[model samples]
Target: MILVTGGTGLVGAHLLYRLASEDREIRAIYRTHSSLHKVLEVFTYYTTTEKAEHLFKKIEWLEADIIDIPQLFLVFPKITEVYHCAALVSFSPRDYRKLRKVNIEGTANVVNLCIDFKVKKLCFVSSIATLGKPISDKKMITEQLNWNPETNHSDYAITKYGAEMEVWRASQEGIKTLIVNPGIIIGPGFWNKASGQLFTRIHHGLNYHFPKVTGFVGVNDVIDAMLKLMNSDNFNDRYILVSENSSFKDVMKYTANSLEKPEPKKDLQKWMIATGWIFQKIGSIFGFKRSITKSDINGLFATSYYDNSKIKSAINFNFTPIEDVIEETGHLFLKDNAK
Candidate 1:
């Protein structure tokens, strides 16, 4: 049986759709109250009634948290392969501990099960953040990049790095493990006020500003790479699963234009990074939602250019441009706006 965690997430949902079509004996784990619930919430938000009903029923879901080792084993008894995707991808400072508990310890727990169950291959869906930052050589990031948590700007980064470490440690124990560090995932789904901010704001015409950030790949492309990894013809070592490094401005403009909306009037200036930090500090002191935190503000300016040639060349895979992902996202949001 194929055991999966975070099955309700965007990547998870997309993976589930693919797995269901193949008639794979799939098992899914979820936190009773998880961000994936909002993934489903977005279905009704963006999809037609017929589409929502059709997609929802096809996914065979099992409710369990990655942290609950006993419960996880119950759903995934004698698993053949495993996919670890559950994580707290939040950047909030206040919830940093919660993020660690789920992203780090929870991942460690899954790795342990791999050892106990003698799973054949374990796939950990790590993030590009674990690589810390782009190197000065301007080459595509490869498996050579040892995960460095020191450069991490957010708790999510640290946790993903730690979880990856767990997988590396488990690999030492005879569990054939592979790590795929996917960049930002953009695809079909609802935002539900959490991720909703990105979809809603951009669709409602608030995405006029862009950050000088980097790293983007499509949900379809990322998933395709994962399936390729499962087939064992790609790189024998860890791979950087990225498409291209583009600025946030390009993504925003492309999105707006694709949705037939007016382009944003302003892209984020370098000065706004500092301004955002100040505003977040003040908001934190006043017990308000700091829309921009120090870590987030720093990350906006931190990303350097990236080259995803290693995995692309190894798998002989050509990536879809960020524009394609952005345009499709725009269309999906516009359709799901619950107009």
Candidate 2:
């Protein structure tokens, strides 16, 4: 039997659809009943409502939180393989503690459970955020980059790096583990969260595009790589799953064209970001939630590229182009919101 955490998230939802179509006996944990609707919504993107609902029903739904060990323990029994996708993604300084608790402590609990259950293999969904900055003379960040603690990092990144440590420990303790550090994942559904919000913001006529460049991969590619790696002979290794390194300006322009929305004409200059960060910090003092942080400001203007050669060589895989991904996803976004 297979157990999946964060089965209702963007990656997990899409993964569940694929696993269900293959008729795999799967158990998935959910924090809320409402989130399960997200899985069905994601399934409908590739199939009719009836078929989607049928596939959704195949998953054994268990309500559990990765941080709650006792509750988490009950779901691990009889689970031979595990997919650890549950994580808290936040950039706000106020959320530092929460991020550590969920991303770090929560992952620790999952790792411990995987050990106790003697799971055959564990696949962890990690972000490129945990990866260190590219070394000198290297243009692309790769699996070989060693994280430097002295460098400033977001709370989310630090905790995820810590989580990777736990997974590495698991690997040493005899559990075959596969860790995938994916770039910004682009997909349809859950328009209000994560990279999905990029489509939403674009459709709503966002007027400013930043100059930073980063790695991006379609959600399909991420899930494909994960499944292949888990079934392959590879274990105790991490793969970077990025399709292309693109600038935010180009990505926004492509998405705008796909959505038939007005492309942003204004470039968000670094000075503007710096000014906003100042006000955001002050606002936080007055009890306003910070929408921006110093680390975020740095990320906003810094151009970072990721290398996908490792994963490509590992799986003999090909990635769908970002332009194609945006076109299809934009079509779906319009269709879903047409009502």
* C-alpha TM-score for every candidate: 0.85, 0.95
lDDT of 2 by residue, 1-339 (tens): 999999989899999999999999999999999888889989999999999999999999999999898899999999999999999886677888988888889888988988998999999999998888865523778899889999988788899999999999899889999999999898998787777777887787678777778889999999999999988999999999998999988988988998999988887766775666434322222122546666667777788889899989988989999999999999999999996
What would you estimate as the lDDT of candidate 2?
A: 0.87
- Over 4 Å off, model 1: 33-59, 132-140, 149-152, 193-196, 233-236, 270-295
Q: Poorest 10 consecutive residues of model 1 by lDDT?
A: 279-288
What lDDT would each prediction earn against the true structure?
A: 0.69, 0.87
Best by lDDT: 2
Question: Which residue pairs clash within candidate 2?
Answer: none
Error of 1 at 267 (Å): 3.5
Residue 91 error for model 2, in Å?
0.2
What value does the lDDT take at residue 274 in candidate 2? 62
